[model samples]
Target: MESEALGHTVMDQRQGHGSLVAVAEKLTLEEINSTGAISNFGKPNAPSPAAIVACVPKNVHVDEVGETEFRISPSEITAAIKAGLDFGGAYRC
Candidate 1:
């Protein structure tokens, strides 16, 4: 696939790197309920783009849990450094 498929928007150089990373955790129901888009998924009577779930998670927490966010922790940064990974720059939309 071509990054140009996204049209005139500035593209990331690594778009064509064909990289896939594992999702370490599943979202809690509370987290999923935070947005209609996520909650609509996996429902038989879901709305458009959700009625037929394409990607199903192996697990989901039905009970309440802490909200999750992707934060670059200091330990993670150190681990990345040890792994010889470099930050390209601040993420862009």
Candidate 2:
């Protein structure tokens, strides 16, 4: 959904530009009972795990836990949000 949000922003910008077009996708919060959702598709600056994952390199590997669900900590989400804020503060994006 975060990725979808980013796409929405792109699409909106395209829409604003003359002779440009973009197909915007919708965001949904389905099946998000466990993992903490920081879904702010309309706000790209928001801490979107999906967006971060999309922008970063995908060479990351973790312990194999096939077809398993996991819990997310609020502290972790807070930390990520802070890091994003800090990066933005430093870079003035």
lDDT of 2 by residue, 1-93 (tens): 876876754445545754332322232334342233345433568564553331333354447844444455667766776687566542211
Could you give candidate 1's per-residue lDDT for residues 1-66 as a string of tens digits? 354685655535565332312321455555544553443332467454523223434455544754
CA deviation > 4 Å runs, candidate 1: 8-33, 36-39, 48-93
Model 1 error, position 82 (Å):
36
TM-score of 2: 0.29
Q: Give the runs in model 2 whose Cα sits over 4 Å from its true position.
A: 1-63, 90-93
Clashing residue pairs in candidate 2, if any? none
Worst 10 residues of 1 by lDDT: 84-93
Q: Highest TM-score: which candidate?
A: 2
Quote the RMSD, in angstroms, for model 1: 20.1
User: Which prediction has the highest lDDT against the true structure?
Assistant: 2
